[model samples]
Target: NVTVIDAPGHRDFIKNMITGTSQADCAIFIIAAGTGEFEAGISKDGQTREHVLLAFTLGVKQFIVAINKMDTAKWSEARYKEIIKETSNFIKKVGYNPKEVPFVPISGFNGDNMLEETTNASWYKGWEKEVK
Candidate 1:
């Protein structure tokens, strides 16, 4: 079953953390592809690790990582891969297999690689089953 929650980041307001994550079975983690943003989000002080760890602890085993705002990073595959490498390592540290994770390159504003595939992300492996 699928339920969408616009859960606030731990840094934003952690008061809702427990309630928001309690209902989730999986996560669509949207990290940016821009310079510094990706790094900052996964850093020790960032909410990404805390929130993801919380979800995992709460039994949210599935994950779909959406690397948003590819446009900002000029759709550089290098940048995408870089973030993926860093994130994959961290994800593994949290006890998940990096190979099973789906890291999608997207531009939320332009909807690149959302439904239809975009040339910008032509290298991305296409057509995984939608989350249901």
Candidate 2:
């Protein structure tokens, strides 16, 4: 069985994020696919990168990089690939092997690629994790 806890993404919520990381067994970092959002979130001043670094430093080993709102990007496989490639490099720089991290393409609004599959991401091979 798995349990999930949320950590806020804003810079002002860094403390809460750290608190959540401290208790988390795994980390799931979300990147938006909307125009300009992803870059802004990973920028020097953004909290996304900082959160990942903190989670890593806090010894959260397993990671899931969820690329959300793919529907806004028209469910383009190229867009998904682009985000994954860019984010993977950043993750690798932070000491995690990019290949070992799971990259999930999801549309939170439509609920695609979560517990059920959808043609919205036909190119994606779905993810399944064995419960321990």
lDDT per residue, candidate 2, 1-132, as tens digits? 777779988778888988888989998888898879988877886667888889999999888988999999999899888888888788889998787778888899999887788787778986565454
* TM-score between candidate 1 and the true structure: 0.88
Candidate 1: segments with Cα more than 4 A from true spot: 127-132
On lDDT, the leading prediction is 2
TM-score, one value per model? 0.88, 0.90
Ten residues in a row with the worst lDDT in model 1?
A: 123-132
Candidate 1: residue 57 lDDT (0-100)? 85
